[model samples]
Target chain A: MSKQVFIPRDSLNQALERLSSKMNVWVPAASGSNKCGSEFVPYRPDLIPLLNRQTTTPPKAVVFPQVETLLSYEYTKDPDNPSRVKIQLDDTSAGSPTLIFGARPCDARGFLLFDQVFTRGPFTDKYYRDRRENSYFATLVCLEWDSACFCSSVGSGPTDMEGSDLRVTPLKDGYLVEALNERAEPILSLMEGDVPTDAQQQDARKLQEEASRQRVGNVDLTRSATDFKGRFEDKAYWRAMVSQCLSCGVCTFVCPTCYCFSITDEMQGLKGERLRSWDSCMFFQYTLEASGHNPRPTRFERYRNRVGHKFSFIPEKYNGMIGCCGCGRCIRSCPVSIDIRRVVENLKENACVCA
Target chain B: MEASATTRLHQEVEASIGRLSTVLGWGAGYDPLHMTPLFVRSPEDIARLVWNPLCVQNLTGYLVKSPGVQPPEEGKKIGICVRGCDSRSLVALIQEKLISRENLYIIGIPCRGTVDIRRLMNESGLSNIRSVRIEKDLLIVDDANGAHNLPLERFLARRCLRCRHPNPVIHDVLLDEPVTPRTTAEDAYRDVESLEAQSLDQRRAFWSVELDRCLRCYACRNACPLCICQNRCIAETRDPRWLTQRVNLPEKFLYHFIHALHLAGRCTECGECERVCPMEIPVTLIKEKLNQITRDLLHYEAGLDPEAVPPLLTFNPAEAGI
Candidate 1:
């Protein structure tokens, strides 16, 4: 049996505090003034984690931040040889061990897709790899799902423990914590909790079984990628599905698996830093060329590319792992309430018609 | 009474459906509590149209956005449904000559106020909503748990709370009786006054904390009908780049400053920027402060008069004296 501990409801904060002392800890907590809504914030002793509700902002930023400085450089004139200049460069490779507490399975699975692009590739992104190497995820088994949630549709379930270092399942009084990997064993040992009895362990197993069996979304997207390619040239279909898209980056910004980024050099008088920030395919500038020619100039084409990237391209390249984790933040946060499930499912029906 | 108003709105659109090549309006979303912008190409599509406080989107931006269904003829007009604030956006578009008034058949609706979804969820402590109903000043929300009754004032969008215009200033056809304005001109700047009263450092600290949470998604800029520089926004421009892609507090602050400065004299107080912000940042407050300055300095209010030019857009050589 995996090393298991039972933390009572009141001791949850104390446990988080203990974890924070060893390493940086992030937990889902209320953001701004919205008590019902949550975002992943750095855990403090005073902060209360909202484990029952899904965070509005995904925990992807914990691994891949919205903005990161790769390196900083300064150029100075050489007194010995005025013709040549001396360059000083500062490499930013320093990273501390991080524990992302209260991340849902869907949020944890997002990193699995990101791993294919960043760490598992021939040319690995060292910056991302450094963060990935140092981070550990304590993912909660999701039981509460709203209309917008559809994690199961994209091959991830509420109880899916694919990328989790620690599996946390909520109990009536507290939580049942199980260490999944070697990295989590130290943290599990530090937790001030009683070893869970066989009854508690059985209860957790039952809950996980029930959660795994539940279907949150109504679409069967097994052949979604093949269907998406068939409708690539169908502008009328794309227009019908995504006409209300505001071309805003809300969908991409809130998405867990969207890893598209743009790198730029920022310079102040003599010193400068190269920065990488999140970029969205939905933006017109994402495809804007040097010659002022944009292949995806309109919302229709841009929306199509977004759907295709998640459903077709990524799955083809990464061996059938759909880019979308289907946490449904995009559906919930979208100004126009455009449903991606309906769009992707429509593509499948169109393929059937053609077949 | 609200039901009757919705019925009357349907009747008016049904009557005008034949003459209109396309009618832009709000329709039922995935849930009843929400509404999505709908494009009505035929009379059959009119049934999807809905009118309620939940219809929060300012549909004026669609006039500039290319539509899938085009007009039958080159000069044939497109129909649009506008609320009090949305009408101002339409007038501003006409004033700038970006869209001609002749090419639009405006269907105006006097709005009481739109509910902020975030506020409603917070106030009611309820999600997974089955349905929502507005009666007088109370909002009734039904979910799987039970029914919740919340006061309208507690849940109204921040912009709607201080709305000075509840009736459309200009429209081809008025669908309902004019609704009374929720707030007066004197009360409009209360929040702005409070923010201004703070010491410089206190004010700086206030914004620094709030703006630090911004993801720099640019949803606020994209949702604004007046922000016409869709693709070439200075925030994203590379040549002579005004701002870097850094997600730091200073860069975020500068991006908002650029957004506010660009709309110094032109913002119509539509509140779409604040509404669409996923971070719940009070972005419209910055625009309101700018508007307050313009009101005091130049005695100008934007989107009120179609014939009048924006004060910043035009200069008076004789009145250069402060």
Candidate 2:
């Protein structure tokens, strides 16, 4: 039987501290006093996690960081041969046991897509694999959602527990926690709380049921890919849809499923490091070939590719599972207010006419 | 007065819709508190246009963006709405000959101050807003919970706090009477001055902390009207690569420096770079410092005079001292 426990409101910090002691823990916290938004930060005793709201920046950095050093190298003159140089390589992995507390279901679901790309492929990324094997998620059953949230439309919901190791539902005075998998068993044992009463379990169940029924967005995007491909050649449609698009990477940066990255070697004299960082298809350089030919030249082609990659291309490759998790960060963070749902829905309307 | 301004704007746009291939204006977004750029092709779409404090975007950047609003086949013009700051961007573009003045029909609106949605939400603690309206110097926000009345200054954008040009510099059709500027030129550089007062180490520490959070989304670059090298930006070029793919502090600092230096004499103080930043970094301050240098050394201000060339773009052979 799965273990169930209740961590009272006052004891929440204590529970987090205990969890941190056992493993590296991360929680959604405000970036700073001057900044208006929050992001996933390493847990500290004084840091109060913003559990009620979605983080402005997703927790993808925990696994796929914005910048990570793949390896470092140094060159030195060899004593045996003056003409030849000796090379020293730094190739140590930094993965450790980690616990991500209070992640929303949408944030946790992002890892499922990452797993498909990094873990299930022939060329598995050792860095991503190491982090994936060591981390655990204690996702909160999300009841709070904004207009930007459309988790329900893309086959996910506020209360979906597809990838959570443990499920937590806030109650009147405490949070009811249920261990969903074996990874959460040790943490559950360390938690100093009483087993949740039968009545409390019923309350959590009711909250989950209501949250699942709530509709976040109105659009049904099951066949979004097919519709997008049908209108691929319609330049007028693309122009009208994304005319105000700043051609910036805000949408992709805030998106939970976007995993495009670029690698480069940074050197200063005899020392150098190979680094990998997040990249966006919205950028003009994303498709710039070494020979100076770019297939996706303008923002029109780039925007179309972004929509296609998520809804059409990924689904075709990944057994009809759409790449977008529908967390609504793209819509919320867009400087021009370009709604993806509206764009995808419009795709179906203009396809037949254009063809 | 505001109601008449809105009416006048609508009538002017409606009148020009037939002669113009497209009319660029603001429309209601997902919510009433937000406004998105509206592309009005026909007279029917003109009804969608609205003018209010929520119209914060500097729409002039669209004039230079690729695959932009095309001109009609039979010598028709393109109509665009410009606020005080936006008109300056248009002026800068026109001065650079990026767009022809004859092809554009400018409908200029006198702006009191545009609302910063982040600041408004923080001040009022209001979200899920149903509607928002500006009455005199007060912002009234209504949500499902209740209504909130906030002082306009408390929720004004950082750019509006020191706005020196509330009235457009040039316009084909003026939408309303000129509005008084919110601040004087003297009070414009207080934020920059305060930063200058700090020690070099303190300033370095401050910037390091701020720029460390940048996701390198490039929203700041894309929103800027002066940054014309859109697809061929030096930051992304490989042959003479100025910046690496590394997201370190040094790379971030250098990238920002390149951006600032490129806009040294050309920036129109539109505040689009700072406004569009997701991390809310005060990016405009960098450009402001450069503008201050140009103002002091060359006695020049950008986007003010269409005939005057940018200080750096043209050289004065007789200029001595160097």
Candidate 3:
């Protein structure tokens, strides 16, 4: 945690206007894609944009959105208390502390794969832990890598802080930063300038370890989570390997790590609210049933429950760690191109023909 | 790879429902083996019409189960029938003006494959087959293990081994004599194009070894007749129950990411969620990689033209040239 730079770009816009006077900063900049020049914007600290590569959508939509309004009722009838139910909680946005900045090391390792499903163990999501504890995050160090980048196979790269607190790098005119959380050492000791020598932190750690060995190398994932909990009944090899699935739903909305959701109730007659979008067990209406039963009722049991919920149930509930963050974005958004690395090399050649 | 076009499209749909039931007195017997929806009103019950391969239902789900799609006291207009994916769902319900191709008569036919009679009574042990018949390239199937025969592309049903339009592309009549078209395999999506020859830890070890047996149950969205919202679903709503009916594995990875993103760009590859999955789940290779991403990034083709449209209700915000 020792590297400071800055060299007057308004001292990084006065440390993003002193973290935007205590809340909401975002940054990134230039939102206008169509091939060529500037795209990833979120801005306000005088329109950020120093350099970016990802963001057609993801910064987990400023904390998971694409459609949000969890509650909103209003069926009034209170002639001196005749019946009451109001129901509100909708227009949110008050909780602030954001910051964000550059975000790149594969979107800061997709917030360590969304803090292992929104903050560890059994349910802890007060709206994604109150906007991820009033945000901050940081990260940048990519310098290059696309054709739908892979997060260097799985260990992550383009910088990898496992979810960043403060990272940066760039430098011929401005950045270096570094920190990596202890709530980023009082914003890197209220960072205001110099402290980058040792040949510019060994030339930004040898160009971030040669841009993480030219973008994505070690992808061995050598079979562990108890070797797929000992081959879960190989249904004739995932039914002759998912018969060219056309189940749509573009690889879980460009997954950084997919998190499914769906619940709607939009009301009008007695005022309504219940809403919770984002569902896709590869759709036949996400496991439909109400007496009509549908146990994964096929697309190959919904592509084998999307490859057994990312390698045997998110590693039997987060211990084996593999709900997919390799980030090839569902193999560059499959459309009959269907290739989850060839269904994991045909489940490692059907686990070497079941040993 | 050839023969069998279901006995010449059921003798050109029983002679075009016997000339639309002798000049519209109401085409013969409308018996879908009497599972209801009758009204052939009578023309000698058109010799109790029949079309083997037990007509695998979807006669537009019996034309919205009859009543008033036109049959209201009319002396005999409703004859119906159909095929090419049930007349492209009656041309997407007459281009969504919801049914009115002149009060109705249709017939159509031209299909070739059908029999999955529950995989032919689980591969011809033939339980109580009784009468099955098809003839030209065999099928037969009589009872207590007698008749037999077989050969129909073995059993058919991979959407009739890649059916190139079979016949009723729209239909109003044209029942018999079509059948000669058979050459499919346009590389039958080469197993979703050999999944770009794997390596991202073998596609995350092939979807975590098949979503470790998801049990969230919804019969692939109720035998999906275009999952037309069966009584409002977001996987069984309950205030903000955003999916936690707890079948496990982050709710079966949030129920296959909200059932493959609500069939993005409207999935119409129709394996009926891999023929109603009871944990058989090949969910059509995620709707055949979302029908090859709406036909290579939005050329769009779901339910082929009932006036087409729906590639995500029109969006080309400069074609995500964003």
Residue-level lDDT of model 1, residues B271-300, one tens digit each, is 999999888889999999999888888888
lDDT by residue (tens digit), candidate 3, A232-256: 4676565444443445555665565
Error of 2 at B280 (Å): 0.7
**TM-scores for candidates 1 onward, in order:** 0.95, 0.94, 0.29
Using DockQ as the measure, the top candidate is 2
* Residue clash pairs of candidate 2: none
Summed backbone clashes in each candidate are 0, 0, 72
> What's the distance in Å from true for residue B291, model 2?
1.8
Best by lDDT: 1
- Over the true interface, candidate 2 deviates by an RMSD, in Å, of 3.1
Pairwise TM-score winner, candidates 1 and 2: 1
Winner by TM-score between candidate 3 and candidate 1: 1
Candidate 2 lDDT over B56-93, as tens digits, reads: 88888888878667755487888889989999998889
Error of 3 at B312 (Å): 52
Candidate 1 residue spans exceeding 4 A from truth: A33-36, A349-355, B66-72, B134-138
lDDT string for model 3 (B215-300, tens) is 34454554444555443567656444576444446667666767766766565544555544433445567666766666676665
